[model samples]
Target: MFYWILKYLVVGPVLKAIFRPWIVGAKNVPKTGAAILASNHLSVMDSIFLPLMIERPMSFLAKSEYFTGKGPKGWATKWFMKGTGQIPIDRSGGSASEAALNTALQVIGRGDLLGIYPEGTRSPDGRLYKGRTGIARMALVAKVPVIPVVMVDTDTMLPIGSSRPRLVRVGMVLGEPLDFSRYEGFEDDRFVLRSVTDEIMVALQRMGGQAYVDDYASKFRKQAEESGAAPTSAFS
Candidate 1:
């Protein structure tokens, strides 16, 4: 009820009127059944705009911090996230990572749309990064197709560290769903996971037209932080 209210009555109408977001290949999203919406993370607004444009409600595994803030602003943030159908998950790897994956599987099990950023984090420089294999694993395990959704110019609308957003037009392009049924039983194989992830990334690159980086976004950011330099990537 809250989700619909926010999307239709409250926040959605305001955002739609302001940004004037557009979408292409919206028909690629299935009207029913479980599937993964794999998107390239360019800005935080990617989460807001993607779901706003889609008719069906979608859920994303948001970092735990979003739900665990202090004060009135924190309370409102938590409320908004919950109202928008986001589930909080700890990003810490190892057992926590496995737990988060399990949570994702449950969402898929319910035959719902689960949005995932395969890059694991937002791109620091707007280039497409190598995807984490977790998305591939989820598709294989859930036996569902993965739809590649690419956000265009979201970074320009709201850059990485900017609080104020520019009144710029943004859009998303949804590609035909990529099926991994051929690797149904190979989910445990790391090589197969990498192969599947790479294949999805390739599709995103073709659709979004972003430079492809062979390295992981998280690793690239860490290196940049250590070296005290701006994030840079050599297209592969």
Candidate 2:
């Protein structure tokens, strides 16, 4: 299929040669079955590079905006995202978001790896922000392992609002799988969900070594924009 051809034959080879991505603890990921690869969102390329490095195809839940653009560029973008195994979904909160959650659960139910960014959005700065409980919700509901992944220097290689890659080596660290079976039957509990989310974030902080901020990345960006400050920096 297109995913394998692009991963093994086309784009993957070119990217590996250029970036020379160094992956540590690759063995931590299971060869098969359902699992959630929980990672911090650094740049847009996080979604691209993670799948290329892994042997199995990773289905990421992407915002619908990526699939709903205009003109030739939009067409290209949509296909590119599709080819990369991304599933487009409405990110808007409330009832509309249920569809995305259903899609994610379906992917996991099919025994496929589902990648998710707990922060919900890329960091305005390099700091690791508080995670969303949605990841925990999915993991607990699906009863799958949550593997924490860290993308080192990815933001530097391809920062936000930058059209070109910097051609620098990137590093990734895959932490051991986190098991939350003790919290089983408590997925609907908001307190338990936040606790699980924080535990995953702590693992990411340890592996990524980024400063931990208790606020969400989206909230931070909104605050910056409200203050009339530019919120486009790769790192603060």
Candidate 3:
């Protein structure tokens, strides 16, 4: 379908030829069944390059704004995101978080791979940020394994606010699948959720080699905005 055509025929080949992305531990991804690919979000291209390198088609819970933009560039962005197998979910918290969790569960319910950025948003700096507990909840509820993925140097290729990507090699590392079956029946426990989320973030930091930041990335970005500090790009 559109995903196949875009991944293999249209956009995939072009990206492969240009960026020449290298991957390690791709065999860690399960060949079948439901699993969550939790990654550290460094740049927007983290979504694109990870899915491109993996064999199985993965779906990401992308923000709804990507699907509702106006004008030609917006149209192209919307088309590309859809064509690449991204599902739009409102990131606004409260009931919206529940809806997104349900949508993510539905993806795994179909025995498909669901990509999630546990950090919730792209890192304002190159350091790994605290992960949101939603991913932990989803994994516990879905009763599936969670694999830690790390996208290398993606921010350098396409930093925030950059309109075009640089021609550079990027890489991905997939860690072994993490089993949280011990806490299977405790999905509703907030303490357990935080513990699970912290465990996953530790794995990512270990694999990705990024300095760990205990605070949330979104909070850091918001604080910077409120203090009149200009957002700093990864390259900057």
Candidate 4:
């Protein structure tokens, strides 16, 4: 109910009317079934804007801090994330990751689109960083296609720490879905996981027209932010 109200009555009309985001290969998104809308991270608005454009009730995994915040701000924040179907993911360590993976698998188990940022964090620079193997493991475990996505030019609207957002052209491209059926049985193998992850990055490179990096999001954080604020993230 909140999602619709925000979509139709508030943010949706304002975003669509102002940004006029161009969506390419939108049909690439499946009408049903479990699939991952994997993409490169670019801006803070990536989370809110991507969900607004998709036709289905897609959900995303957000950092746990958003839910466990302090003060009246924290309470309001938690309520909003819950109302919109965003799950808090613990990104601390192995145990946390496992828990997050289980949560993600559960969502996939129910046949829904899972929005994930392959880069883990938005690029401090615009370059596409190496994708995490979590996306690959999810694909293999869930046995679903991973649709590569690229969001262009959102850093301008809501760059980090800026109280006001700029009105500019934004774009999201949904590329052809990637399938790894040939290596179905080796989904748990680490090397196979890396191989599949690299494959996803390659597709993102094609769509983003940026050089690819084979490191974690932290490695690129400083570079991605030399200009202030990364230009990427999860669809929701």
Candidate 5:
């Protein structure tokens, strides 16, 4: 419906013509059935461009704020997000986090592609950050393979806090599907989840060609904000 119209008739054509985005190892994506596309978040455009490049639509768990806002810009943002089939969830942890995870499970239950940024937020720097274990937990609970995807140079095209985008090329690299069936019943164990997450991150680092940062991206953003220093990013 609206999603297809936007993809085929409008946004998709325009973006592809401009950026000429390309993908490698696209065959790794399952043509049918549920799977997780675990990606490194470098820019907000990562969510937008990934779906347009892939033949299948991917449902991303976006922040609740994208769905709730005021005025014209807010209205446009909400509609665009909905039209793209993104789900809005609170990321403030606690019960809200559990609810978000449940929503993701529901998407997986429907045998759909669920896109997740394991870093929890976009990288403040080009370096990949330690992944959040939620993606690992969902993959284990859903009994699906996790496909590592690396989005290249999207930050340069449309960096965070930038209102205007540069007409630059973008590319995506898909790594072989990772099966964690061996750790099937160990999803409840925090250590196991961390192990699974780390394994996925390692694959992403190799494919993305970015330095690995042991700290969380959110932590770096927080520190930058506290110090009133501009954050570093590949976009620069």
Candidate 6:
């Protein structure tokens, strides 16, 4: 109810009118059934922007802190997430990965779209990073097609710690769904999984026109902090 209202009546309408994004390859998204949207994480808005473009509802596994904050702000955050049907996954601790995978599997079993950033966290620099094998493991286990989505210009719209997203036109480009059924039962092999993940990232690079970087997003953030430089946006 709240989700629908927000999607149709409030946020969705305003966003569409404002950004006026040029969405390409939207036809790639399946009309129905289970599918994985493997995307590059560039900004906080990346999560919200992609879902609004697609007609189907996608459940994004957001960081748990959004649901566990304190005070009035926390209450509002919790309400927004719950109302919009987004689940919070604790990205810290030893069991974080397991918990996220479990939640994602449940969503897939229900034949819904699951949004995942192959890069574990938001990219500190615009360059594409090596994706975690967890995505491959989940896709094979869930037996769902993984669609590579490219969110162009979102990194500049709302960067990390940017009190609010700027008024910028960001686009979403969806690529053909990549199936991982062939790699089924090979989740235990780290080498194979990393190779598969890299292949997926390559597809994303071609679609989004982003530079390829082997390092993870978090690593770049640390580098930026060390150099006293701001994080790079995916503008070019």
Per-residue lDDT for 88-150 in model 6, tens only? 988774788898999999999999999999998888777888888888888878888999998
lDDT of 4 by residue, 47-149 (tens): 7777878888777888887788788878877877776668889878699989989999999999998999988876765678888899899899889999998
Tens digits of lDDT, candidate 1, 151-178: 9998898775566789999999999999
* Per-residue lDDT of candidate 2, residues 1-236 (tens digit): 99888889988999998889888888989998999999998887888889988888889998888888789878887888899999998878987667777899999999999999999988978899999999999999999999999998888887755667898898889999999999999999999999999999999999989999998899887787677664564222
lDDT of 5 by residue, 1-236 (tens): 99999988999999899889999999999999999999998787888899998898889999988888689878888899899889999999999989999999999999999999999988876789999999999999999999999999988887655767789899999999999999979989999999999999999998878999998999998887678675443222
TM-score of 3: 0.96
**lDDT tens readout by residue for model 3, 1-236:** 99999999999999999889999999999999999999998888988999999999999999998888889878998999999999999999999999999999999999999999998988876789999999999999999999999999998887765767888799999999999999989999999999999999999999978999898999987787577664554222
Pick by TM-score: 4 or 5, better one: 5
* Per-prediction backbone clash count: 0, 0, 0, 10, 0, 0
TM-scores of the candidates are 0.95, 0.95, 0.96, 0.89, 0.96, 0.91
Runs with alpha carbons beyond 4 Å of true place in candidate 2? 226-228, 231-236
What is the model-wide C-alpha lDDT for candidate 2? Answer: 0.89
> Which of the two, 3 or 4, has more lDDT?
3
> lDDT of all the models against the reference?
0.90, 0.89, 0.92, 0.82, 0.89, 0.83
Rank order by lDDT, top first? 3, 1, 5, 2, 6, 4
Q: Kindly give the stretch of ten consecutive residues in candidate 6 with the minimal lDDT sum.
A: 227-236
lDDT of 2 at 193: 99
The TM-score obtained by model 1 is: 0.95
Runs of candidate 3 with Cα error greater than 4 angstroms are 231-236
Model 1 CA deviation exceeding 4 Å by range: 226-236
User: Which is the better candidate, 1 or 3, if ranked by lDDT?
Assistant: 3
